[model samples]
Target chain A: MKANYGYMDGSGEYYITIDTDKCMECSEHFCVKACPAGLFRIIEDDYEDMVAEIIPNKRQAIKYDCAPCKPLEDRPELPCMAACTPQAIEHSW
Target chain B: MVTIGIDVGAKNAKILILKDGEILISKYRESGFDQAGVTTALLDETLAELKLTRDDITSICSTGAGRKAVTFANEVVTEVSATSRATFEMYPEVRTVIDVGAEEGRAIRCGERGKVEDFAINEKCAAGSGAFTEAMARALELTVEELGKISLDSSASVPMNAQCAVFAESEVISLLHANTAKQDIAKAIHDAIASRIVSMTRRVGLNKPIALVGGMARNVGFVHSLNAAIEDEVLIPDSPEMTAAYGAALIAAERAA
Candidate 1:
């Protein structure tokens, strides 16, 4: 759970967010690989076709509604930060 | 040559002592909380029970989430490699391996020699992992062990869409309120997870003669759903739970030779 570096938000708080456009463009699903909680998956149709959509499958709707970075303990470790090849994920306050 | 494989899993630690192709001894114990401490204790106790010492083990390997933390291991191997090796050893015809443990689910393709060709793992969310099922079991006031047996008897089937474990629990509650049979609900949970896992397995290309390993592999109901989803008979070893440890042992033996 412990790692180096962090992100900052405009409010002077450190945070990380996923840019959907970058995520869609990225070919490698590194986020899926880096995640410890098994929260992200590439959607597939009934015909068993791998789709390009990437979704965060959280425990509850309310949990998803909360800001992307609620709390370290409340959310799965952000694999997107490590997965982003283009550095599309920004950890800022 | 004597070899040993230790699987320091999140919930349990297991040791397998082997000589050539024969299993000398195997032991599994609940890993209360500490990974390193519990693994050390388990290894010590198991070695003592077998009247063997650390030096008696020519090579040592570790597998599972806490593999890296096992200081006793000479080499740390990925679960994908270990699972495929173990599955291939158990069923030489097995070309695919599906592992569902407490925290992750993985599907691996093996080469003719049992080397990992390609693999996919679900380590990000609980929806497709055993933790989701455990959570659902807790909410239903049933032990996780009861779910598989109970689910096997259900005639009716329900559909659950929530891919998130927490959301899935809520869905199960709603279904229970509607007088849904527990078996039906359990079956739905297995089905939902199977669909997700099958999708990943298909992504990696599911060949025939698949082997299911890991703790969740013990769930007969889930195995049925997995088989049905993939449209193939999922091969499960008699000691499905020990596959990972066995795989580690296999690796240790090879290293020693």
Candidate 2:
């Protein structure tokens, strides 16, 4: 299953897309540690497959929660996306 | 047998009672800190008003952000499916559905028979949802209802730059400091929210006629802005907030049958 999290607001569009097929294969759950905001969690999806998803409580504040990692100058690859070896995560800005 | 649908939304909990495929009664209350408790009491209160007993409800399907809390429910459905089912029932011609609740917003594309074709959600931020307008209203020193009413009086369009609700509140104050009209500020608030929703809807393909549901449908100011943003008049079902619950009831009815 492919799940899209985050939202588009007045300022801009911010979305985190996750491909669970790739996520389910990686047990390390590296994204959980990569994000300083603790945005990702390994949850049992509707299909009973354990996959990464944005934490529910964090859904309402994705823009601010993800900002510290994305400075205006010389921003590196997002820590969460950088750590995911399966390449299951993406950000739509 | 009657079937009941409960939607424990982010800000409101709604219950719909259906008998023989028709709505019998529906009610809603604030979700509050105790969603499960509030919903259970709401169901009991609604039943008492109708002089019906719990036994009359043979099945119950729950949906929304707090669906898992409804443990007594016979089944659970996602808000997307529930709203599409209800929208299809109301307007078969509607291929797109937009739902903006307190804390979230989503755009759903419905194919034949309301099966969800594709959908996009503005889930993580409160700015695309009713909660943004609510906070803006507070910042403008007006009630939410008053804010909606005053928005209609505006003749000017002012752009709001803030994406976060907290920052938006600060911006509203700055606009007031600049002596901007209250009505213009209110209109800007609605326009900003509508813009985000329209952008999200476009991603899923804005097939018309669009049906607008959820709590925000009742806000005429938002409705006006949304219609303008979509460039096509949107269809709003009667008592739009209950669409999700009504659809869940329909699902419960099917399961019972």
Candidate 3:
């Protein structure tokens, strides 16, 4: 039997999953480089607006969201799946 | 049996002539809006060199980044169809095919009998592509061929941020200013590009016996880093860039048969 897979034309079914805990302190964010679809981008979320960055000796940092290399139907076979060195990124089936 | 295939891509064109499971002639050329004229010229040139007429060709098929552009061809197939067909023909054991070009890159999964079962493509960016590599090489005052050779010599890893080619160029310039080693920078770029390809390939679910094709496949550094990143040996065709065209020709032959 032939197995059916892959995204239909102009539509895709893969979603990028990030283990935020693994990404919190990682430096070599290769996910930003590996997605040929231009799906991964470094967007620094402002914690000050959401919460606050200043508090004596508090380890406060903003969140970085790694998205699909491009926008498609719901999602894409995310190019970030294998790029994360810490195994922090995944693709939802 | 004779068959012809044409691949009209964003940055280039490829033509192939095959007979009885053998490639007789192949040509690669740059493509433009006037694809018909360009294809005619290339065909005439190749036919003249091979001492054959267009009538000698029994069937025609087209594929590539611009498969739909070959209006004069007998049939136009998806690059996925043609890539899987051609890759399986050359290496029947191949389960994965990675095609990287000037404009985009793709990962394909093929099953038995050379059928494409799953695939992923990146059509949006110049980053992690042949064109981006070429542009970076020019910025570094190096040729694409020399870049790979020198990149392999690096002893350290230089960090590069920026997924866009434009931003990557800025990052490269900054790295130069920061006195980062050139070889290290080169290796870093390869690593960066490898990161993207690995991500895409993983989406398609990398299995064993991966084959790489397209113009960027000619880069030894890419091959090395890609192999290292994935920890799998890569299979590249004798003429790695022409695999897509050959696949198109194979489809033409199949249809004729």
Candidate 4:
């Protein structure tokens, strides 16, 4: 289950996508702690599985919220993406 | 030397003209869908007021959300760099800057000489920015400025549970339906934003004297809430919205020199 958060605007597309299939295999959820904005939260799905999800309030504004981290010249690896050992998080920038 | 700095913010376009390190003139206008057009008009108007023209400007720099739209700018600077530079210039003792604008919030930690050491930002969430306050104010049937003043009269703590701006609006309406005092609701809104700002600032490590810039800095209620949230005094520039433009102008001055 790939959960996509954020939307596209005139500036660009920004999405914090989480692959729940990979997320369920992980024991420790580091992504929850790694996000400076506290954008990730753990929620139980209808299937009774716990997974990481982007907080609803942050879904629309990831472009601006993540601006300090995403520089134009040389985009460094994102902290949340780097923290997820399962490689479940991806940013569509 | 005369230089110009333009800040094309999400809601407003601000321009500053610096003459030999002093701010000669500053102008602000609503962006109104066309950021570049509004910015050019603002610059031209300011220059005309100063009896100058674009040719008189040694350099032109731009910053903020719509900075890329400033086609005529000689350079563009990041908001973090520009804000820190302007704050440090005004208050040399400031090591931290908390800027809450209409659409975003940023906390910057700076080293000596206003170099950005670290920073944190809350951009995607309206609940933590000035927009949240504006929405809440509209729900309460109060202007943004009126909301700020009324919040100062709040005597009791009314905690707001909603973390999302949309949810918070419904919450405010419910509070109003339940006959909760408007002053308390206003305080709750300011407190919510202040707490979010404090947490963001903590990520960068707060150091005093911390200066608050951007449009929200003018809100007395929000400033008080921030001071209480951080348990420390925070400075405010004379014209908080112009900090970014001032910093950009200063950079242009440096480049010209």
Candidate 5:
């Protein structure tokens, strides 16, 4: 199960993709701690399974909130992605 | 030379006209659905009041959330840059700026020259912004001003549990039904916002001589909450809402020169 968060705007497209299938296998939720903006959280879904989710309010303005970490030249590794031991998190810029 | 700075804020559009480093006039109007239209009308009205025309202005700069909507601006600056610039110009000793607007909150760490070294923003959520207090005030059947004033009289501290505005509204109503003092609820609301803002400020590293800008600065209760949370005296300009516009004007002056 792939969960997508964020939206595209006049500035650019930003998405934080989470592979829930891979996420469920992992016990440590590092993405929640790695996000500086506190935009990530773990929530129990309809299936009563714990999954990582993006805070609903941050979905629209992810571009601005993540702007500081975005680099102009080379793509830098994101802390949230790096922290995910299962490599379940991905960011599309 | 005359320069005009326009801040297309979420709730209002503020315009500041500067003539040779001195403020000539400042005006603010509610920003309706059409930000560009409101800004243009504001500029026209200000220019008319000062007996000046657009051509007479050496430069025009725009800042705030809808800054890009102002098509006539010579340049567009971010709210962080503009607010820090204005705050630093007024109080050179200010090293940190906490701006809580209607829809957003920002904490900026600046150097001695007012250049932003680091910053954090809470734009997506309304819980920590002025809108939270406004919503809570509506729930309490009190005006925003009255809410702030009444909060000062609160003797007991109440804690707000909700982190979202929607949830907080219900919490406020429940408190009201439970016969919780309105003053205590108001204080709780301010304290909640203050704690969120203080945590955001800590992200960029809090420095001394902090300045609080934006419309929230006008709320004495919120200011007191921030002061208590940060455990430091926070400086506020005469017109807290106009800081971004003033900074934009300063940038326009510099660019025109």
Candidate 6:
């Protein structure tokens, strides 16, 4: 299951996509520590699968929160994605 | 030349026609699923009343949530910039701005030219926005307007523990069953929203001469709650809901110039 967390408004679209299927196979929750803002958390989804999800309060402000690691001027692979060896993470902006 | 701003908000689509900073026509309608269709209809109605055509307008800027749906827009501005422009045009002294709309709440630190230096928004949570008030009003069997007015009658502070709007509705029902005063409950609802908004606003640093805009600005109860939370009365511009659209029109005019 691909879970996209974020929102779209007049400003722009900001979302963090996580593939729970790939996440389920992983024992190392590196994405949790990889996020500088501490936005990712381990949670049990409705289907009882333990998955990494964006924290409730921080989900709305990911654009600003993720800016440090994902600067537009000289962009590199996102910390969260680079930490996720399963290649389960992506960003929509 | 006439410039136009169209705001396709979550709850309403509003259009403003401006010429030399003077508003010629302003109109709004309850926004449904078809954002662009609804806005075009609203624009047509306003133009019909003003005896103007799209060609007569020098430029058009679309803003708010559904701004992209307005394909005819010459430009699209974000809500933060739109709010900043409108605030500068209306209250240049304002150094901070808090806008609470139906779906979102934002706190902006404004610069001398009404530029947004920084902003924090409550986007994913209904508890931090006007939708929470609407849910509470429905649970209390009162109109949204009536709930705001009725809350003003209560002096007692009732605490709302639920941070989610759906759970808050259950909390309201429980309070009602326990024979709690409706006005007190209303006040609690507004207070809860205010606390959430204030916390978010604090992130951007709430400066003096703060201005409040958006549809929620019209709620007197919310305003009073916000004042008590911040220990200051925020400035409310005329037609607070229209401020974003007006700001967009101003941006359109500047871009055209």
Task: Report the lDDT tens digits of candidate 2 across residue range B13-89.
Answer: 99999999889999999899898799889989999999998887899999999998887898999999999999988
lDDT of candidates 1 onward, in order? 0.74, 0.88, 0.74, 0.86, 0.86, 0.88
Give the per-residue Cα lDDT of candidate 6 at B184: 99
**Worst 10-residue lDDT window, candidate 3 chain A:** A56-65
Q: Tens-digit lDDT track for model 3 on B9-85?
A: 88889999998989998988888887778888888899899998878888889887677667768978988888899
Q: List the residue pairs that clash in candidate 6.
A: none
| TM-score, candidate number 1 | 0.74
**How many collisions between residues are there in candidate 5?**
0
lDDT of 1 by residue, B1-257 (tens): 88888888767888888888899888888876788888898888988988988888789899888898799799789878888898888889888788988888888888886898887776757766889889989878888878877888889878786766777789889998999999989888888778777766764567787788888988877888888887878888878878989998998888778
DockQ for all candidate structures vs. native: 0.04, 0.04, 0.07, 0.08, 0.08, 0.05
Docking class of 2: incorrect
Over 4 Å off in model 5, which ranges?
Answer: A1-93
Q: Could you give candidate 4's per-residue lDDT for residues A2-66 as a string of tens digits?
A: 98888754334668888989998887999889888788888997667788998886775565467
The local lDDT score (0 to 100) that residue A49 gets in candidate 2 is 93
Report lDDT (Cα) of residue B148, candidate 4. Answer: 92
Worst 10 residues of 3 chain B by lDDT: B120-129
Candidates 2 and 5, the one with greater TM-score:
5
Write down the TM-score of every candidate: 0.74, 0.75, 0.76, 0.77, 0.76, 0.75
What is the CAPRI rating of model 3's predicted complex?
Answer: incorrect
